[model samples]
Target: MNPLFAFDDAQCRSLAEAHGTPCFAYSGAVAEAQFRALREVLPSRVRLAYAVKANPHPKLLAHFASLGASFDCASIGELERVETLGLPPGRTFFAGPGKREAELRKALALGVRVQAEGFEDLARLEALAAGALAVNLRVHPAFDIDEGNRIIGGSGPSAFGVDEEDVPELLRRAASLRHVRIRGLHVFAASNQRDASKLIAIHGAVLDLAKRLHEAHGLVFEQIDLGGGLGVPYAPEESPLDLAALGRGLSGLLARHAWFTGELILEPGRFLAGPCGVYLARVMRIKESRGTRFAILEGGINHLIRPLLTGEPFPVKAVGRGEGTIPYTLAGPLCTSLDRLGEVALPDLRVGDLLAFGTTGAYGLNEGMTHFLSHPVPPEAWVD
Candidate 1:
């Protein structure tokens, strides 16, 4: 079986028969394998925090928690999901550009570290904290970010963190806050990047930025979060990230930066979850409009929206069908013409043919427009 697809034809058929069409199925074995693959290669000082935004499935959360994984949460719902694990403090981190006071309070109550985006976050956290609090300042670096998709909004104007140029002034203003202290630095400058060397270059730049901040402001960091962007192959032609190379680069960085003794943090979401899921939907009908042949599935963007957002479709195959030279434009059952999965080559597909989409464990259903058109939401099965 291709690593891109979590299940073989037999497993896909079985899952479709058990869960019905237009549903999702995740393999716990595959998810754990991915986590272990990355974890084994990482340095001892590197903390692996599974980004909860990827897939907050309770079973998935519990599985990762059992492996002693930390969690990276961005919303109250994610925090709540992680809370159900009842893990000890310092195993969770809360981060967002616009965190509400209620969310901050919840984070504090649960002993979650806050990734402060700017002075507003610091001020809000200070107001909410009864005693002293420490946070990691999220800075939007001025360096060029090499991302194929503009998911993080690049190095230009962004709504995510404090701009690199404005950090000095923000730090000056934050000095007066009595209850909140910036004890760490956070910089997320990559997205879905696969090259280990490129990711290392980006991480090195972030560390250099941290060193400059420390030298200039006399700040001491307990942690430096190199935010998530660790990528996974969406298609077979694309290669998976080089875990060994990534580990070596990080270890080298730690050795070089002896002045900073804090542990490095990697919040990986897609790389850890993408390969374990398979979205199975049967073809509703076939349409040959103009020169294009469309295989309209029972579900569309409502269930899987990453194709529309990233212009990159998840790897898919017609279950029980052999390979062919025939081309197909995969479409969903949505009302709009924009509801497309992707254009691909597959065996001759017919109505009721089951199509299994691979690499959807992360940013699959949860990121879709579930409330659109009143379509029935697809059920997700956890295959243990």
Candidate 2:
């Protein structure tokens, strides 16, 4: 559980030497293992759509596809990524707000399942298609969690789904549309939920809503895309995603809602890929100011951007097996003073030593930039 030294001892040396510092290292086997764990719990009726935004690298997506997993794309661009990989149309789902008209047209053309976020999107899709457009309803699940602590999707006044009270009317409206087809219901309120009961409650609520939608509209659902937010461990002692509990809960829910027959979809982003990768950086300098030790890394917000923008902390560990204890605040190479990674209690540090951060698989690479300092983009390696 020591994130600092969790990988195969020999493999760590191999990665450091070959990929160099400040690079992201991914494990293909780890990714597959995570997928397999979840797959083992659910029935064959369930289909996992690896949320591409988690790690959209071509190789990563290709690996998921090989594991017989589908994809959950938030935009046409993400959909196009899956399309290029030759995944089947029905296996891919397009879900998110601000789905433009052009994007809807493209999704329809490609036969990708659509989860309409708002009434405007539903109306637009209805107007464009000649036949019932394969659609999913995103319901705004009531969550008992804070917004700032949660990720984009769940709870906290999310603009992602229709209100529960309006769902029946929404389905009625969809039924009225000659070109709109409502096939599934989706709900995702938050990610990184350590509480298993919250997820279970969310899923149950979604199923309950699905039941009402079905009864009210006579719509037989073919899928229920429980938008994935399975959290990965960030702290060294933190447990990895509790797959056993999630699977059991989901299975129980399916049994409870036996009347619904269709694929059970999960769009997991962090759970699959977060622990499988590490962001490496070389210490450029060690300085002390105002009683604070600063370890300025070669890469900055430009290279791995989220922490700076959101003030959220990512798990970090120093490489090279240092044993001494010291406290230091890590900062990116960006000129802006705000580009901080996080403060960590570490031993004596030296320049050129490699530092790796854990649980950055979700947004570290895919969402970083080359702005400000514009240091050369770091390289990446995928391991089995």
Candidate 3:
């Protein structure tokens, strides 16, 4: 099997035949390999928590859990999904901006660490907890963030976390809380970034911010979570993130910031899960309009919406057909004109020809409009 596709032509054809087209198939081997690859390079002080929002497949979650992985859950549903794993306390975390009281209760019941988004969370947790409780403060920093991507929303006015400048006041208010205590700092300001240096720089900025808070407020952090932004290549031309360099840089950061003896956490969802899965869809028909060759697929944004949302297509290959220069505008079966996956070069595509999209294991099915158009949701086959 080619690393790009996760499955070879024969395997892809077999998966398509077994599960039917317009479906997702994940390789547990790929998932483990990705985890081991990243984990082996990271510093021992760095903790790896798999972000459950990437792909919440039960098998996927359990598989990561089996590898001694912690989970970063974003919603009550995700918390429930991680709950099914029966992990020990401190192995799971709940994070989101709008957390319901029930959700906070669930987190409390599960003994999962909560990444509180703002003062509301602190107040809510204070009311919910029976005794002293520790949580991480998810901060929206105002400096040195990658502003190009859509996921993290960069340093601009964002809804994800508490603003950095306002954290002091929030902390002042939080000190009056009876139970909830801030023990960690979380900063997620980048998304799908490939450069190791850039990621390290952002992380460095976060540490600097932590240092400022610790000095000014006499705050002590038990953990500094560098939230999930580690990237995986979406294209053949793109280079995978250099994990070795990343580990070295983090090790250096930890050594330099000796005053902060707390653990550093990396919650990577896409970086860990994206390369382990593939989406298989068949060409329903080919239409040639004025200037474009359209290959309409049985699935599109309804199954995989990253290309439509990010304008970046997954690396695709026409199984059983060799590569060619014919450009194809890959569109889904949706009625809207906006249901385009991507326009890429491929061999002559025919009806029933299977198109395999690689690096789709994470955000593929989980982030799509599967219920739209009343199309039958495709089955996701987990190949262990």
lDDT of each: 0.93, 0.77, 0.91
User: RMSD of model 3, in Å?
Assistant: 0.9
Report the C-alpha lDDT of model 3 over 1-384, residue by residue, as the tens digit.
Answer: 567788999999999999888889999999999999999999998899999999999999999999999999989999999999999999988889899999999999999999999999989899999998999999999985654657777677899889998998898888889888899999988989889999999999999999999999988999999998898888778898999999999998998899999999999999989998999999999999998999999999998999888888899999999787999999999999999999899988889999999999989999999889989989999999
lDDT of 2 by residue, 1-384 (tens): 454223543565678789876678888877887889888987778798999988887888999899999899988889888888886678788888788888888888888888888777789988888875778888886654443455664454567778766776776666567777777788776676755667788778778878877787687888888888776666667666567787788889989998987888888887877767777788899989999999999887776777766676676666665544788899887878877888788778888877777666677787887656667777878776
Model 3: how far residue 292 lies from native, Å: 1.5
**Model 1 local distance difference test score:** 0.93
Expressed as tens digits, the lDDT of each residue in 318-371 for candidate 1 is 999977678999988889999999999999888899999999999999999999
| Model 3 steric clash total | 0
Pick the winner on lDDT between candidates 1 and 3. Answer: 1
Off by over 4 Å in 2: 1-10, 143-148, 153-156, 309-312
Q: In each prediction, how many residue pairs overlap at the backbone (N, C-alpha, C within less than 3 A)?
A: 0, 6, 0
Backbone clash pairs in model 1 (N, Cα, C under 3 Å; residues 3+ apart or in different chains), count: 0
Worst 10 residues of 3 by lDDT: 144-153
Q: Order of candidates by TM-score, top first?
A: 1, 3, 2
Model 1 spans with C-alpha error above 4 angstroms: none
For every candidate structure, what is the RMSD over all alpha carbons to the true structure, in angstroms? Answer: 0.8, 2.3, 0.9
